[model samples]
Target: MKRTLSVLIACMIGAAVSAADLGDDGLHKTPWMRDTFKDLREDLEEASGEGKRLVLFIEQRGCIYCKKMHEEVFPQPDMAAFIEENFFVVQLDLHGSTTATDFDGEENEQRALMRKWGILFTPTLVFLPEEVPEAASAIDAAVAVMPGAFSKGTTLDLFTWVDQKRYELDNGEDFQRYHARRIQERNNISQE
Candidate 1:
């Protein structure tokens, strides 16, 4: 009985260490995530002023995929540093009652805003461009939207692609192509 109890305690401690810290809202909290008044227009302005792109991270409580991202992909030094350097991240609760101002100057609850953006996933990442046209909603102005959790390589590639404005380039390397190329490069490097 004592051995079983010790084993249980050890497993609990290991799980705790592997998981990211949770906020009062029950969402995973990262050091790079900013706490704002949920005003997206102001958030965008602040991000741009800091030479970083505005990224909206939509998550909810009890999401295993969100937990996987926070634990496996986001905590890596390269991934974390890259995100910190290039993106001003804002966390939005999918079911929270907190008020959030949209880029179109419309104010609504965070959940309502998520509905407006057509978000149906726990870990949707909305990447916004630097300049938003007047009267455009956040969804309409987004350069890219990652709708679910991705592996570290894919996440890094997406972030780098958005940061480099590869979507605007006429080279015909879309995200699919870009990600495939990166995978091939990684494979080749691993075999060397």
Candidate 2:
């Protein structure tokens, strides 16, 4: 009986560890998340140089939704590879004091910058275009903003849509239409 109890406890501990791989800041950490200097302009330039989109991932510590995204959605192989290949992700703490320089030459703490942009969500993703105007802030220059945690399908679809630049298409097939079509296409494919 003692051996069984010990095995159960060990399994529980393993599950907890696998739940969300957290960093010292308490935010969920992923292998694909970039450790940059938090300067949007420089980060954008580096991402451009690497031929990837600049993505600001705003998340707070102890957020269950953020945990879900980190563990359930982001760990999916396809999503991970897609992001690693096409996006340069910069992580920002929602309440952290780390200084982040905006594209407009303004420097502020991560929390203050998020407040200025009216973003109170824990896991907001601000996706940027290839080039941003010098006068615009990072939030102002965002081509797409994902407000919160989403399923792998929705998240992947958003990432794909932004990567493909479907937001700027003139065919009137916006994200909703694109997402619906993707859903239908996935449904039609046999999972043999």
Candidate 3:
């Protein structure tokens, strides 16, 4: 009984340490990221006189990779600075009940929106474009619904491509090629 109790305590301590290592303190920190994201939403609304495009990053509270990203990626000087300057960044907890207002005047809790939008994994990024009645079809087709973790360079390239409206120019081209090209361009620019 004594030996069993000692082993259990050791396991518990190990698990606790691992959990601490994977928590939020390890994730990316763009202090202005949240504000930028909210502003992006407002800017989109102003630009199109409806709602412009904005990006939403959805992450779970206790995810380790989420922490790794918050700590390892966002805080990188280039990423943090670029994100602050160019993007509207908001963090949504996948399991929380925080209220969110859609442009269509619909009110849904965070978790519900996650489900409605078919989000099945953590660290999903969804881009929503300004909504206009006549352009609903265009918005539906052009706005990207992406999910999963993305490295800083890849993430930056995606937004840059979106801003250039490259999607419209690549009617039938493969997505992989488009993304690869964007990545290459970013790499080349960084090298220079």
Candidate 4:
């Protein structure tokens, strides 16, 4: 009886360690992602109400890179908490048949939207400004877009940069510079 109890506890602990779940659609699910009606305008408004930035993640099932992000970087406590606190994330499947309304008031299946946005990869992150042009599609109005898998620091730095609205500044320190400086800052802190 004691051995069975120990085994059960072990399984539970393992589950907690790898918390990202595969949904019925075969896409990874995270607690921080918002399950909305897939309407960009409403999602943006809701995110603004909560004082968070709007981010759209375009991913497809069976995508190894997407799985890597879900199981690796996104599940990290700090990364997860930072995302939950600062961003309203909406996940749109690259091949999904579910209808999603774009910021331009155009409606299409998730797959169609992916093509319309000219996204060719999984794990593409679109960061939007606090306000977008009324007739612009999400891709056109995005302030920054990160494609493919990246290290934890790069991902965090991008999120931070967008959240801080550094893209809107006249300082001309773009994401590359910001990320480079952040890398140096992290290295220095670790060395200290």
Candidate 5:
């Protein structure tokens, strides 16, 4: 009985530690996340002014994938540092009532905007270019949209590729090819 009780206590402690990282909104609280008025155009301008790429991170409460990313992937030193230095992150709740103004100047509740964007998953990362065309929505102007949780390498590669504006390059190496190359490089390094 004592052993079982001790084990239960340990599990509770671990859960508490993990939950502490989350904010009252149940979103993972990261220093890099911007507290904006949910205006995409202004966010884009602010990111460009800071010489950083604009990234919209869509998440929902009680999403295990979001928890995994917050605990395992994003907190890694390299990933954290890379995001902090290169991207301006704006987080949006998947089911929240907060008003969000899209790049095209259409305003709606957060959930409605998510529906309009056709986001069906938590942790959908929308990476935007520095310059967006007039009358283009956030979804329309996005350079890359990463859906669901990804491994460390994939996440990092995506961030790097978008930041470097690889999408603009005429190089035939698209994201799939680029990811494959990176995986191969890592395998070779590990083998060596």
Candidate 6:
């Protein structure tokens, strides 16, 4: 009985260590410093011309899920390749006091932008170049937001859905079904 108990305790310790590692790893052990808005704006401008969209990943320091997404999901070989090729990625900190002038010309700190943008939670993925010919402004307040954690499959599906402009009709169908079909299609292509 004592030997069995000892083995159980060892396994628990190993699991705890694995979880801790996942919680601490990110895109790099050092946090990514924010890029200047001037440079980012120029990059976004170029991306718009090329038909690539913006993907803003909102997170906070010390967030375990944020770390996991950056380390595990974003770094997945296929995921990284796809994101790098298709979208301009930006990481924003929700609690940060750094100022950013949004495309709307609203000058506010990051935290204030989070609130002004109606984001109540972390790990939100806000898509941009929100203008599309249908909207009045380049950044539409309503259409740019997608919140919360998404598994790898869902993340890729979202990018493809947005790229294809399927989001316009996604509202009419079951979102899960639509997203699943895209995932399956991607799998088949990748396998081929």
The model with the greater lDDT, 5 or 6, is: 5
Candidate 6 local distance difference test against the native: 0.59
Q: What ranges in model 4 sit over 4 Å off?
A: 1-18
User: Which regions of candidate 6 deviate over 4 angstroms?
Assistant: 1-34, 38-43, 130-144, 169-171, 183-192
Superposed model 5: Cα runs more than 4 Å off: 1-20
Cα distance off (Å), candidate 3, residue 170 = 3.7
- TM-scores, in order shown? 0.90, 0.88, 0.65, 0.90, 0.88, 0.67
What are the per-model numbers of colliding residue pairs? 0, 0, 11, 0, 0, 0
RMSD of every prediction: 9.2, 9.0, 14.0, 7.5, 9.6, 11.8
Q: What is the per-residue lDDT of model 6 for residues 56-147, given as tens digits with 9 covering 90 to 100?
A: 77777767676666655665545554555567666666876777666656667777877767666667777765453332222353344667
Worst 10 residues of 4 by lDDT: 2-11
lDDT of each: 0.89, 0.86, 0.55, 0.89, 0.86, 0.59
TM-score of 4: 0.90
Model 2 TM-score, all chains together:
0.88
Tens-digit lDDT string for candidate 5 (73-177): 786656666777789999999997989999889999999999999999998999999999879988899999999999989999999899888999999999999
Model 3 regions more than 4 Å off: 1-29, 35-43, 46-53, 130-142, 171-175, 183-192
Q: State the lDDT of candidate 3 residue by residue for 1-192, as single tens digits.
A: 633554455445532222113324333344544532233334345445422245677788666667766656555555544444455556666775757644444457767766766678877766655443432321243366556666876666676566556666757644556788777887899999
TM-score of predicted model 5? 0.88
Residue-by-residue lDDT tens digits, candidate 4, 27-46: 88888899999999999999
Error (Å) of candidate 4 at residue 38 is: 0.3
